[model samples]
Every structure is written in structure tokens, then in C-alpha cells.
Target: MDVEFLLKMGRTKGLEGVEIYKVETDSLALTISNDKVKEASASKTFSMGVRGYVGKKVAGVSINDENLNAEVAFEKLSSLIKTSIEDPNWVGFPPPRKGFMNIACRDERIVHADYAEVMKAIKELMEIMKDEAVRNGAERASVVEGMVRLGAQKITVANSEGVHTEDECTVSGIFMVLKTVAGRGESDKSFWIVNRRFDFAELEYLGMNTARLSLMFAGAEKIETGEYDLILTPETFAGILASALIPAFSALNILEGRSPLKDKLESMVLDEKVNILDNPGMPFEIGSRGFDDEGMPTSAKVLVRKGVLKEILHNYYTSARMKLETLGNGFRRNPSSPTTPYPTNFHVQPGESRLEDLQQELKKGLIVYETIGQWMSNPYNGNVKATATHALLVENGEVKGPVKGVLITGNVYEWLGSRLRGIGREVFTSEGVATPGLWVEKVRVAGE
Candidate 1:
């Protein structure tokens, strides 16, 4: 858990530098149902992962037991590192200096939330959503158990050459499915109170909204294929952007020529209004941490500024290869990916317009709320063609009605930079990304 410990141990082993990361998590979860077929249940899980580096030769180990002493774990880790391949491009470790100071990743709610409170909240959400399903004549009414607990006491250690930091956060949420004879629908959403300072009202609203949206898609239909303007809400755009940006920001991908933005630094890559930032201290994100897995201090950097490619995420290995300093984006689920680039909290700064204003500008466009296979869709060419489950037909600057099974196709980068018309001031944070509602022009939509 201590950076100095790892450094001292590494020196004793004749290594130049050492980096260590320890993550301990406790999770409690439950599911419930009132339907005749499905039942309710609850479960709890506790786990810890330890990753260490011996001059770029990395090793990882995980345990469900926290009782094991750190020294024993490190001994096993050191043994494993001896058999690992040396990283030729390794450059010791990242600089251990904090920059652009932000809020520390500490949440009061997480420390206080108990199992009973989590269970009660889950039951409440299930009851509300299930009641709506029953009213719609669902053949089965089921609720998944709710849970509460701190997810991890995530810590990162870097020697004099790398930054070290420690912080803890909480993760808990609920999900359910309502089967209706008219059709089928599933709802999945989570609540992470990492900040604990924020009110729960927004979380409650999100739960209710998700349930209602799922219900709206029951009698969906396909649309005819044709070009149309499209509006993407904050909730829908976050995941899509994550997939696209990850590749563009990945140092390895850039080096391998897999990223289109490679060698395109300072070039326009997005809309002039779009500014993508990485914040390690985002108010309430499970991904928020003081330092990266390789002991690099997390900091905010604009990848795109005024539609220009400004920066790329980097780790020790990649940065060394490129002869650049680590930007502190290095990450690893375990030792296997040490010095790999990954995001902490990717964010898109918002605009001035309101949602209502965005809607008014949508005239003759389709508003896409959700999509399937977004993760599989390619964005390197800036284009996306995928089926949307939740959407609305708009005409004369207003929502006409619900339209389902619509395929929306468009170039993501071009559409956002060129055809992207507006952005709403309302920004929502989810899945480690906070984004605003977006409006894009001339997107191809296919349906009945």
C-alpha cells in the first residue's frame, strides 16, 4: 500500500524502480420479484487486487481475502515478476508530481451507507417500476435485489520517479426486467455515490426515467432508411464517445497506426465547441483516483480543443517510446496491462442551450435516446450505423411520438464536428463520462 515500500523492495532486488497498486472492494447486492415465476435474492462480494512492477516487468495477483499480509503478497508478486518478460521500452516510472489540483476522491455517503439502507432503496425502486409493469399487464413482475457497500480502497504507489496516491469510493445500484405480453423490456442502471455530497434526487429521477423509457419501447417498429437530422441525449452519447475516444487517445493504438488521429496532433478532430477533458477528481466517479495504476498523478488534459486534436493519453511505456512525459492516463486491471493508457473520468464540456432549445431546433429530425451494439460499432472513420431502441420522431421542432427499431447511421467525428448543430446545457454524469445533449444534422435513419 506504500510507494516507498515498493521502491525499497525494488532497490533490494536490484531493480531501478517499483510501482504498486492495491484495490480492496466490498459489495452487497440484492434482487427481488413479485412475479409467479421469478424469485428474489441478495449477495455480497469482497475482493482485493495487487499489482506491482519490477523495472517494467509487471506481475499481478488477486485475493478475496484481505487478511493476507502485504509482505506475503509482495513476495509472491516478486516471484512472479522474475518470470515475466522485460518491457524493452520501459522508462522506470512516471513523474510523481501533482498538477491542476482537483477534489480528492472521498465520499461521506459511502462511508455511512449500510446494507439495510441499500436494500430498502433497491426494494423501493423495484416496487415502483414493477407496479408500472403490472399496470401494463406484464405477465411476470420481478425485481432484482438492491445492495450497498464501499467498492474499493483504491491506492496507487509510485517511487521518486512516480506519483503515489490513495482514495476510497462506493458503488451500488439496481436493475430489473419487465416482461409484457405486448412485448419485452429490460432496464439497467446504477448509482455511484462517490462524492456522497450530492443529493439523491437526481438518482431517483434517473431510475424513474429509465423505467418509463423502457416501457415506451414495447410496441416498437422500424423506420424507412433515409437521411435525417439526429439529436443525441447526454445519457446516450457518453458510451458512444467512450468507445470512439478510447482508440484515438490510446498510445499503443497510435503507435501501431490503428488510430486515425495518429500524427494529427493540433489538427481539428472534433467540433470547435467540443472540449474533451480527463479529470481524475470528477465529483462522483468510481474511476476517479489520485494516481494511475503506474503511480502517475491523474490530471485533466484536453484531448480536443476547438475541434483540434490536442493530446493523447499516455503511460510510462508508451511515453518512453514516444519520448514524451507520461500524462498520467496509465491503467491496469492487474499487472498484465501495466503502463497501458486508460481514462479516469472522460468529460465533454457543455454548451449554453437548454434541452427545450435543442428540441426547438430539431425540426424534421429524429431524437435517438438509446442504441444497441454501440460498443461493437466502429468510430475510427467517424461513422456509426446502429439500431436504436429508444427514439422519437420530430417534426416542426417538436416530438411527434415514439418510434422504435430505428437504425441511425452517421460519421461520428464528422457529424459531431461539422454537422453537429447544437448542445444542451443539461449535462448528466454516468459510466465515468459526463456529457451534454447533442444535435447532429443529416444522419441516415432506416425503418419501416
Candidate 2:
């Protein structure tokens, strides 16, 4: 709680430095579908993480109890600290920063929005969908969900370097899911809307569209496969791109010699049309936090600016070990998870053309809507072979019908910069990234 206390403990315990971070979260969720309550849930958690550095060796511990044994935490830390080695690359924590983080994420209405009102809204939305002719065929059809997440978090960082920083903020999130049924065909469509400032109305259209799409997906046909150009929707694009970028953002991956982007600075790594940005200050973005886990000023940055390789996210430890300034990327959930580099809000820039405009440019191609086994795609090798599900067979620049059992295989990099034909307009945003559709000139598509 106090810098002096933590510093004294670190010194008396023969530790190099110390840090304590805490998180308390309260969340509420409601689900309604086909005008019935499918699921309703609420959760609350209070957690803290402690990290002690003894030279090059660092260990993290976390506990759910506020009555955490500081002595025990420190004792265990000291034992691990004993294994610490000295590295010349070690730099201490960042200096005390003086500036207030702009508070863009806050809403009193959400904290006050009653459960009864939330349930009513859920039922109302379902009623609207039902009246909208969404019933195709089904043993049952329903809309599911009303949800709210409201919480406050406080993070305090103090180190032997005389740097002390603390931040407090409130956050709220809302999500809805629409479920459709047609005999044995049951599909679920979801839309997540979250921000500190926005109201439930902001989520209405998204939820409705998701429901509409799910209804349209019924009776989808299997695609006859062959090589075809492709247009990737924003959701599909984000799924593929997040996998590719996750490895590039990992310090452990870089240190372990697994990241291909390692030592690839100042190189044109992507298509010139692409701009990847990760910013903590993006307006209304949920992941936008005031400070990184390591107490560095979390701000907007260009990871890939107009196709040139730009920067990597980092925390105090990785920056120190890597001989670079702390980019505030450190993460340690007590012993719950490993500390490593991860992004706050990763995104690719939007293009000029709309989804239809990009589709018009596609003289002939298939639009792969869903993929199976994407998790198995290798980030290191950038190679992916996925079974394309719910693909749209495009001919002469128009979607004919939904086709199943298509496969799209190619290198992620090739799909990013090489085969990149153009980008589309309709940006579907979530979390912190907003991107429209991505159009690639070619991908190996095999089907019959």
C-alpha cells in the first residue's frame, strides 16, 4: 500500500524491487431468447498480484484474499529471488510520471441501470425479432441475453527505483446473443457492446444484425471448391490477424527465438496499405487503460504504419532484459498465469471501399465466412490450412449461395501483404479494433 513499506521490505529481504497490483471486478449478465430466459448470471472477484525482482530473477504471486500473507508472499519471493542472476541489460522501473490519464470510460447510468429494466429490454428485443419474421423453421426460436459489467480497479506500482504510480478507473460492458433454431440446425449469433460512455441503445443495431445474419445462415449449401479470390469479413479478419500478431507481440517468443519478426525492425513487413495501431487512449475503447501493468504511460502507438514495421509492446521486465525502454507490457497474475508481452488494443486500419464496393472488385472468388481448426495454424511458420465452413461462392462479383466444406490454405503473410487486393469500408469494431472486410486476390480453395 505504501511505497516506503514495499521498498523497506525489498531492501530488508535482499530483493532488488517489488510491485503490488490489485483488481476487483463486479459483473452482471442476463439472457433471453425466443422470449424466454436462457441464462442469467452474475460474478464478482477480488484479486491481487505481487512481483519481486532479485536482480535478473523475477517471480510473481497472486492471491484472492485481501488478508494475503505479505510475509509469506515475500518469503516465497525471496526463495525464488535467490535464483535471480544479474544481467547487464537490467534497467529499473520507470520514473514517476506526472499527468492525469484522460477519463473516457465511465458511466453512472450503467451502475444504476436496474435488473428489471435490463430484463425488460432483453424481452423487448426478442419480441421485436420475433415480430420481424425471423422464424425460418425450428423446434424453437428465441433471443438470449441482457448483460452488464460494472467495476472499479486500482493499481499501485512502487519499486526500489523510487518510482511510484497508482491509477483508478471504472469499467462497464454489455453483450447479447441471439439463438436461432431449425429442426436439427441450431445456430447462435452474438454481439458484444461495451464502453464506459455508451448506453444499451448503442448495442441494439449490432444485436439485431447478428440475429438477422444467423437467420440467413439457415439452409446454407456446401460450396463446390476450386481456387478463388476471397473477401474476409471483419470478424473473420480479426480472428486470423490476432493469431498472426500474438506471436509478434510476445517478448518470451522473441527471446526464445520463436518470433519471425525478431530483429526485423525498419523492414517493410506488411502491405503499404496496412496500418496496425494499438492505443490505450482510443476514445470509448474498452481496453484503453491509463497505465500499463508496469506503470508506464499507456498511449496510442503505430505498430505498423502504412505497411512499415514500427514497434512492439513491452513491459518493464522485457524492456529491461531487451535493453529498451519499458513499454509497459508486463503481466503477472500472481502465479495464475505467466508474465509476458500482450497487447491492450490491437487493430488494423480501415480501407476506403465498402464491403459491396470491394465485392464488386472481386471478378470471381469465394467468401469464407467461418473456418475450422484455425487454432492449429502455426504463427511461427505463418502457414494455415483451415476447413472453410459456411463459405459463399462468388461468381462474376456476387454471392450465389452458401456453400459448405470449403478449404482455404495459404501463408498468413501472403494473405496479408502479397495477395492483398484491397480493403473494404464497413468496419465492424469490437474490443479496441475496428476493421472492415479484407479482400485478397487469391487463396488456395479446394472443394467439390
Candidate No. with top lDDT = 2
Tens-digit lDDT string for candidate 1 (1-448): 4447655765675555555555655444344444221333333444445555666686665544444565666677778888999867656656656563555555656556665665556556666666665565554445433333333344435454545566565553434443333344443323233332323565566555554555555555566678888888886787678666556778888887777788999988788888888777776565676667765667878878888888888887788898887567877755434556877888788999986787887778777787776776574654566677778788988767677777776667876788889988888776667889898888878787
Clashing pairs counted in every model: 18, 22
Task: Give the lowest summed-lDDT range of ten residues in model 2.
Answer: 130-139
Candidate 1 similarity to native, TM-score:
0.80
Local distance difference test scores for all models: 0.65, 0.66
TM-score of every model?
0.80, 0.85
For model 1, the run of ten residues with the poorest summed lDDT: 189-198
- Model 2 RMSD in Å is 3.5
Which prediction has the highest TM-score against the true structure?
A: 2
**Local error of candidate 2 at residue 145 (angstroms):** 7.6
Question: All predictions: root-mean-square deviation over Cα?
Answer: 4.5, 3.5
